[model samples]
Target chain A: MSPYDLLPRFKAQYDANNQEFSISGVVRPQAIDELGPSIALLRDAIGRVRGVLYVNVRRLTQMNNAAFHAFSRIIIDACRARPDLKFVVITSSVVGWTSRKFGRLSGIEPNITVEEYDSEFYPGQGFLEEGGFVPILRSQTKMTWRHERAILPRHGMRQGIVMADICCGIGDFAVLVQKEFQPSRIVALDHSISSLNYARQVMREFDIRGIEYTYGDASEMLLDEAQFDLVTCRHSLQIFNRPELILKELYRICKPGGRVYITNEKNSHCLGEPRAESIRWTYNEVAKLFGHFEMDVELGPKSRRYLMEAGFEDIRVETFMVTNLDGDPQDFADVIAAWADVYAGEMATRRGDGAEFVARFRQGFQDHIFAALHPKGYAGWPIWVASGRRPQ
Target chain B: MGPVQHDLAGEPTFEPMIQIDMEIKGFVSAWRHCDYVSTYMARMISQNRSDSVRHSNLFSSAFNELLEVAFRTRHADGELACRVSRHGATDRIELTFPCVPEERQFYEEAVSQVAGTEARERYLNSVSGDLAPSREIVLLELAVDYNATLRVEEADGDVIRLVVDLPLEGLQH
Candidate 1:
């Protein structure tokens, strides 16, 4: 059965409650609040059943600590009242919370069971829902496609060398590659110490071994001449102030006959005027630097072209269009809220009514992003991904 | 894995469980109090534990090793001489630096650089009542004796301060 087949079952079970209920779910307080009374009633009913109370909450993009604590308290109280009853919680894996903290929380109660499902089922589900910018290119579909099409095949050949993933936010690709391909050694590199810590915790919780995690600037850290068979970077190249310098560093650390995989998201909005100029600068810098090496390039308006420009051989770019029926006004609001927190410091320093400006921008941006996914709105933005290999 | 032996003092000498737990606790505490110097120092000491069996009490041995490492390394010069004063169950660590006249001037410059105009003005206003016209007259009196070097360079009439290399000897533990 598809992972989503359980959603209706969860809804049906949740709807059948008639008492004060405590609902323990991941990444959504607002949605829980909307369904509060029904949830409370369900808790009361579940208290009487003497059977296990399993709650499967999906599509939560963000939640805060207070909300999480409140959710935990609800479950604790329910368990306290019904010692015979077991509480099972299934969370979506979109925001990368399958770490030691989550594991500890899952095992908090002896009778409680907590399980985390991956991005395939929980796209756009996380705690940073409304305030942070979820990169348009790092969507679940795009990441899965990249892994299935490129990462797995390359590493599955019993390659003796390790794979270095630079600027690996949350270390999803690194962890997935290690698990699926079983590389000799995997080094997950990210600048943020917090991200590396989280990645380490995830690795520990999942019992994933043979991976070394480091926190440092990729350019500074890649100064070591140790060559790797594969160097993969996805959705992280855009933020670098010096893409060419980084590309040179990538080439320096890659072994002879090794391949450097670069993936990025391209949209008309990002490629217009100032942003377009920035993209052009990076593209030109990459072209010049990679020209010295045995390289190939692919260019498309979507994911395909961005990879091609980075000098990969046997170029292939595919656009995967994803549509979510759950793209409601609430989802838009959540995205806006998440983006606000991220841009709060920057927005505060700017002139004019920053809150109002952000609110409007978020609403408009949400409408635009969802328009493509919605039949009634504009077609979803085309996600372009391309791959090429370095010649031996 | 043999009979977990204890020392004559009744302390677990070869208890792997106790050793691993101590190590894990040290690691966890390092992550917990990552912002504090003492916690970071503790973490550094914990990380130095190798498979070699040694004949020293854990705390004092760790402290001595750390001291040796700090003395030998570049971080020693930057080491703030921390005095640990205990009161009942609580311990307070006080760090004091001796400020020479040149170092004072450099400190003032650094403070000014950080505070900017508005903050400096506010600070001056707050301390206006304590200001005396000839208070800055004594130079030698303001000089302080400290182990760390206070390097100062003149930059367009501004004092630019630099911290000298520190010996990282005390971290050996």
Candidate 2:
């Protein structure tokens, strides 16, 4: 029988391959003897491991003195017995206490170390988090809100529901949602510390309340299961190499019969009237460029398939086009210009693209902007909106 | 009989946010009361913070340790009252409960011990060296780790109050 059978309120897993032992959930046993099975499992796991043993408590939301004393004994005993074996305790900032609590172990043993598990969250999206990119994110959200404000209600968003916006970059969308839908409680979470800081600053400046901007990794969030009535992750899945992991988390957080709403773009579908060919070619290359980095920029149409595979029911999908005429043509042109600077200047150069290819790539975004600003011209970007209900 | 109020000169005063009073027997009847009270109170107080999830997590952890200590040390008779208040960035939690002379002495000594420079070292040793749970460990953790200012006061009758002033919002950094 698994050691977990004895501890109903918690889970303990030992991964032999990685020499990692993870304990998650509320561990508040009345006595240390109650943790016998889990302690034995840890001792056995430590006996078989060599070099380094990773203890991951990122998701351990609560642990009382009994459990803490028991775990401390195991760590101290293991250090004294195996002088060469290093112990690395992985903690999460989301838990708030794991880092400070486990950090003391390093001082007790020379071989023991504690590290917060947050690094390299979004691989090719680093440029999007630069200080300069904050304004662009705001502009992008403003442009999209024109379409999404109307589209949200159709996707099961309404007043008085508890909502969560995962991968909420800069939180402009959450602010707009709070003002419009008036969700009873809104938790806007993102992996970027800079983004969350900016979001908090914006909230403070605007005196906006009720939206909680939290810093967390999207794939393994600290949020409890079945907590949110509606969970929305916008334009985020396509940026991750493994969109399925994010989908699983979104699915996990949504209450039964609640909807998970997501929006993604098919970059190749970007169109403009006067400079249509150039815009199409550049955007298609944008798709290919993101593909080279393991991201799927063309995951828009495949949202239905992903949702179905993730075990969602009553799936709904729709597509909307944000055009230069949506509000201000200047805003659309500015977005394209920033995209050109990032895609051609930074992303293409980093990809080792030749001068000729970079020039051509730059030309396309410039032309798209040209069309957006032209009096008779029209520029449009298509986004696919999809929502599915978690099985009741 | 009533909630304890503290007003110090030149010190920032707190505005009362929530108060809960219950029989000490009902509270210490189950260990889960520590969890329930801490989690529920943390959620209710953290709703307006910049990061409610993070604030709630930290608040619950610190508050749970306090409640756990109270559970292990309280006298059997009389009432237990928990009051939470706020002033700017700081949060104040006042836990008033029935305590005999010995129980009050334990709290007084523990609060003084945690105020020493070696409080963190004592906390580390308390958790690592001893097999049995220590009542002073939670107080040390709050004083040293959470950077909370803890005070013990003797109230009317057989009741004693533990006041914890935590600048929780600043601790997020």
Worst 10 residues of 1 chain A by lDDT: A119-128
Q: TM-score of chain A for each candidate? A: 0.47, 0.92
Off by over 4 Å in 2: A1-8, B1-4
lDDT of 1 at A293: 26
Docking class of 2: medium
lDDT of 2 by residue, B46-158 (tens): 88876788888888888888888878754789988898999888889999988888988888998988789888888888777888667777777888668899999658988
Cα-based lDDT at residue A325, candidate 2: 95
True contacts kept of each: 0.00, 0.69
lDDT of 1 at B38: 38
Assess the local accuracy of residue A312 in candidate 2 as a C-alpha lDDT between 0 and 100. 99
When candidate 2 is compared with the true two-chain complex, its DockQ is 0.70
Error of 1 at A41 (Å): 78
> Candidate 1, residue B60: CA error in Å?
25
The worst-scoring run of ten residues by lDDT in candidate 2 chain A lies at: A1-10
Candidate 2 on A1-392: residue-level lDDT in tens? 44533446788889999999999888877777778888988999999999999999987988876788789788888899899899999988677778888888888888999988866658756878763987888899999999899999998899999999999988999999999999998999998888889888888899998889987878888788899999999999999999999999999999999999999999999999897898899999999999988889899999999999999999999999999999889999989988988889778888999999998899999999999999999999999999999999
| Collision count of model 1 | 56
lDDT accuracy of residue A113 in candidate 2 = 94
Error of 2 at B137 (Å): 1.5
